[model samples]
Target: MRTLSPFHYIVFSPVLFLDKKQNSYYKKINNSVGNDAGSFAPLSFYNNQPAALPVPWDTMLQKGRDSVLARATNNSMGINNEYYNAHIKGKNGRIKAVDFEHNTELKDFRMLMKLIRAYEVDAYFVMQPLNPHYYTNLKDLNPVIDEVRKEIKGGRGERAYDCADFFVTDTARYDKALLTDVMHFSEYGWHLVNRAVMNHYALK
Candidate 1:
């Protein structure tokens, strides 16, 4: 087992990992998109631009309360079938029925687990909070996470935390007050996740 330290701990969400081939595809689409506006490839909804300042409290609250924002965010991350289709296989507003043998992300994830074990690195795989109404199912992601746990020396328990389920335990957690878009979290939401991690590790 590895001890937790600044360099030893690697916390990440599996949903965001893209393989090398995917990167190449993104670049190709990006280049082609400029030449043709009606290109079939999914356009990137993620904004790489830096924020001018911290998000206001009112804006944070609006994330969950505003139907337009909620629909747009959910559609962009979920139903739009842009980026998700390339990496995952699912349909009808869902993206979590992962096929272990075919998923490149899971393959890379397993490789990452092997590296972590070889290097004795402590890591945590998180499933971030989702909108209750969102079609993506976090629980469907358990198979890969569970598979990787057996590879790590002591990977279960503190190593993974499904914040999506945590939010369900407390209604306050999923409320609009902690929302900052559907996929991202507000400051309070992050604080809750941090506290959960600390508690999982028995850290005071």
Candidate 2:
């Protein structure tokens, strides 16, 4: 599973191994811009500002949700926009259910936990909520989530929040208006997620 990439060694090797004296390339780039300005600000002149729009941001978001809802209602359970359309489709164009087994081999998750512990970083993990429109049953998802929750409980203690049922539990948020597609959420769903995060990490 070790995929090699030349970009990692070529880009990050100089910064990791060489000091300021040896690596002047980064230092020169850093010093090129003033204290108040960004180094790459000049390079991004064309795409710096947001395009002028007719409607307000809130209206734009509502329009986006409306579009998604229209598409979801017109299509078959939003499968046309869903990424699992081709992957999960079986004979007679019926969506097949998958069986998930408990897996404890979370090597990357352990490595990440070690890194956060070493750096003394306050990290929080959120198991993003799923749209029931895509997955009506949680029987298959439970085992995988159980394993992940076990790892997080053993590693990060209470720093993880399982919001996998956030949308499904509430019938109000379980609509296509809250979802951009089958997998991803819309602005409204993200706002709910933001509230959940704020509530979980609120100052004591």
Candidate 3:
């Protein structure tokens, strides 16, 4: 229900963001979306240094992306060992595959569903744009997202009562080269997302 990203929004549109700041487009969405609507986590990708907050969102999502990357790099050598069955601390300190990287914290997508259920959300969507293409991309990660949805859905008992009832979608399946990194989209990526969002909203 929530997305944590290290991208800075300003990199995308200074004029739009500045206009949003003045007109409060984000605030309007925030006010309309209730607890059921879920939230965006600390989107540091939109701000930094002085690190002002991005508009229309509350709560930081994940730790700094750099910090996660650094930790993962340290474990890169260990990855080969795990692949070879020479695992270091296999069962002892297993980080879930839910994470984007080893250093990334395990975000319980199920827990998010629980909150959305509590809020009585009718529809839910989570958007995770490509981070680093070398790390993971939407086209290849659909199955993992599906698994997370199943786990978050829980069972059809009381737990099911806590799941988002109507619908939930995670849309990240875009092309690989669409991003230079998290925030700056490649020209094609930008056009793709632009068309996608417009189509989503029937904008043209």
Candidate 4:
């Protein structure tokens, strides 16, 4: 089997900076599963396989496994259906506003950039858009965004794309149709993001 190593190009998003807690949780899940789990669990299933799976059976099994794993991890992290549902409904109860000046996440982000540069990798950091409804202090976030841009440029010497800026000068920022929830973009919003990225890179 091929081991997963660092790649040539990496696209990071503000989601990394925003949800720092998720990183620790992912580590916990990895530790809980242990190194032998993947090898041993699949071995048992391999010996009992039928000639062929029924139509959609493999897909269903994969989905079921994923759902169960996700649920287990979320439960371990103290996230329940109510919390998830509130986030989906554009609630900001758990969303932490970025503290651009003194946020510790920036230190980690800068370290990441340094590591990526050491490997001579082309790295792109994307500042994702947030649902306007989710933040009552939208005006306060502008400085935070500016600080983020400055920090990335100072540390990586590479300009990061602030996808949120594309909407700032337009009426689109207020359009709820552009977002699926508190932090995710809808299809049209993603189309705009793709266009913006292509244009920035001068891609044909």
Candidate 2 lDDT, tens digit per residue, 1-204?
132221221111110112223335544566676543333233322235566433254665566666666554444444334543544342122122223322223444555556645544444554555445545453444544455557555543534423323424233455556655444566665655555544454411
TM for every model, in the order presented, reads 0.39, 0.43, 0.30, 0.43
lDDT of 1 by residue, 1-204 (tens): 122111111225432223344545776777776855345354332334344554354554344345333433434332223333543243323344446777666577667766654543444455444444343454554565455444443465424323223333132344543434434565555655555554454344
Residue 88, candidate 4: Cα error in Å is: 7.8
- In candidate 1 the C-alpha lDDT for residue 119 amounts to 45
Question: After aligning candidate 4 to the native by TM-score, how far in Å is the CA of 191 from where it should be?
Answer: 1.0
Ranking by lDDT: 4, 1, 2, 3
lDDT of 4 by residue, 34-148 (tens): 8543443222212454665233434544554444334323322222335446543334422344464565565566677666445444344556555444444445556555655
Q: After superposition, which runs of candidate 1 have C-alpha atoms over 4 Å from their true positions?
A: 1-92, 136-142, 145-178, 197-204
> What is the C-alpha local distance difference test score of candidate 3?
0.35
**How big is the positional error of residue 127 in model 4, measured in Å on the Cα after superposition?**
1.3
Q: Give the TM-score of candidate 4.
A: 0.43
Model 4 residue 174 lDDT?
62
Give all candidates' CA lDDT scores: 0.44, 0.44, 0.35, 0.44
